[model samples]
Target: MFKLIIMCLKSRSNKSGVRCYQNRPSSISRSDGRRSRFGFVGGDIGDQNMWRSRPRQIHINRFPPSSKVDLRAALPKAVQGSKGEWAVDEGPTLRWGIAPVSLMADDFAAALSVLPEQHHRIVSCVAAYQSHALAFAERHQVENVYTSFEDLAKCPNVDVVYISPLNPQHSELCHLMLNHDKHVLCEKPLCMTEEQVTKLLEKARARGLFLMEGMWPRCVPAYHYLRHQILRNRLGELQNVRCSLGLPVSQGRLGLYGGVTSDFGVYGMQLALWVFREVPRSLKVSGRVNSEHVDIAADIELCFTRGKRAFIEVSAERKLSNQAIIQGKNGTIKMNNYWCPTRLITEEVDFEFPLPGGDQVPPTHYHNRLGMCYEAEEVRNCILKGSNESDDFSHNESLLLANLMDTIHAELGVGEIADRKQIPDLQRQIEKVQDIVEDPEELASETCRVVQDVSSGTLETKQQEEEAPPRSKAIDAP
Candidate 1:
């Protein structure tokens, strides 16, 4: 299995509209053919303008326009798209290796199970086998299973390492596999921080080790068709793109605000930043207060350097709803279960796009693994060609996500940083990062009358449920 690991739009000062695209010049640049020779830097489609793709810098104003445009400072040296001529190689008759690294194993394991059915491509299963592992082996007629990373990593003959550790562990494990001269398909957020991400990019370049983030959204032919339609302008001028998926804190942890925004909101937030192809400039969060006056739910609003904008609402207090809605000036596209639910709705320019492109799925049938199978395939393909890193989910991309998350925490509220043991390890880092929490009274007074400090002089639990949604991680992508 490939492993990897945000707020809905909280509105503040609803009266004053935010200019989502401000300082950055240019919107989407036109490119039919005759693209730039150096697609590496200012040449590719994602380049051109900040509004059209992810912002290159953490702080937009800190650097000049030139510095901002060439965001490839830390990308892998061996730059190559999952380009053709390198179409995914046919699987080896006898499967080479298998490694499961994420909490959810259904997708990766399922992909492995099919190897025997189709081509006998996968041979061994390693890294903490779960209940499904045995059934998969039996069904696929394979016989090897490992319950430890040690055994998997130590397999000298193992051709590929299937990695799916949590967000924090992805970087080191990926590096370990690559260093072992084994190909690797680790999950998304492949590196937790920009520093670690940078390291992976360099290592991949040096070793020609295959690496790709687990983002299944790209793998589906349906999405490719969607992009094609959008590119053709058959969809018309896209006005707003909004997608959200959230769950209550898996461990019921408390975050800066009572609603626990830290753990799960990153996906939504990252999506907000990514789809717009811009960095979040000013982030806003608005929540209602209970008797204790703690923030329960927030409608988080992120204004990008470009005008493209997104809002997410996340709350533990509500039933689960994961949806994606994209509205164009002339049409709309909506999905029911973004995390692999089968139902979706697409209405455009007096026509509702059918299931071939969009539809709906009942919740009862939603049993797929955390949809990341494509990322794993990408890794295998890259390794087969002796290439390292991938066009999608480059090391820089993961690092940017981490840095962006860290930045968002700093802007919205101070995230109390603690390791798994809840021991503070980076007081200095925290201090350097998150905004200095002023007196609670200051925020209470500043936001809304509905919010107030407690009589006991402590922030309360549970804020108003705003629209801001949490980031969905692998589970969020559909």
Candidate 2:
């Protein structure tokens, strides 16, 4: 049964803001004497429309519309109601509060639309601008709209917050929501640095709140099938994983803090980690950076135990095969659009899992993005079970991925976008080197000398310098 209980705030003469509290619903026991995880008993799991025949209920408590209210004091504790508090019977619907209307936020809403109404609902939203908040509220049918994170954090009815801002804003916003005792599911690349991700994990653990990186692939059915195959020894001893993802784009990705490795390569790296389930023994990376010192293309090799390895190539300059192949001693498994896979091929069988919302265009920016619903369902399940982290994409996995990204960025000499002062210094150094090798013959000789030193692991010999051609001729020679 679905029920809605909304507690609206009414201004009182002396109190700064209105405060309300409602008791949480107890789990309902089935005829077999087992309690349903989500407090409701329903038909078979495969019947998607079974909930439509059952009753539906929604409970939303609106935050005060005043700036003078002390949010910390107005908010309720994470635990259930205390003595003497009014109790309201409600369903197990988890209230969601989204922030900063963006493409990802819309995608999340679309995903929620497909889920059972008794399990999840969007009750509140926070936007940077009033107009955006109004528009998002109108479009999503959300009644409570706030413009600041502080206000969103003060909302007592919001059970969890789905943060989908820019890449850099992820850490700060996640901290805010967790501090407010709200569960969080932030987008991938949870933080800009490994240390930041560590801190967030620590905070989530200390607060006893659920936290997960929105690496949607981990929650999809195809990935589950692949994991099953590995666990059952269907692929034998895994040896190699080769994946490539790339796109031909210029402006948005080539700017500061915009790198193809972080934006596109993370999917491949996560997949490799999922297969190997351990840290690589040693790794090597080579990538080309644009004039802004941001990586545009990269070739990464991760060497693991027993000579197993993973090769990944990611680029923003052009398109690649966009496929992942896992080679084992017994057979190979290939995945198309491995990042958000819908098709899987093994020697024994070919599996296809099409995305939800058939024939309806998804409200997402990327391909096969409707798969995001799987992750949303994962979050709902975890929160309902009172878990602090998901086994599919755990804290340790996120930490490993963050550390890997840090290593790749450091090797590529890509600095944080916030560090603007280093750009001029780097440009000046380049100019100084150019000034020293102004003559074409001198430049060509220096290049040849460096190449010889690198190739032979020794100083340049006279024969190497003698073989060097002029810069113009060398350019045409290649």
Which structure among the candidates has the greatest lDDT?
2
lDDT of each: 0.42, 0.64
- For residues 281-302, could you state the per-residue lDDT of candidate 1 as single tens digits? 4456654433333334556666
Query: Which regions of candidate 1 fall more than 4 Å away from where they truly are?
Result: 1-103, 114-120, 127-142, 249-263, 269-275, 278-282, 285-299, 341-344, 348-366, 370-373, 412-478
**Collision pairs in model 2:** 1-55, 2-55, 2-56, 2-57, 3-56, 3-57, 3-58, 4-58
Cα lDDT for residue 79, candidate 2: 15
Runs with alpha carbons beyond 4 Å of true place in candidate 2: 1-91, 360-363, 416-478
Instruction: Count steric clashes of candidate 1.
Output: 49
lDDT for model 2, on a 0 to 1 scale? 0.64
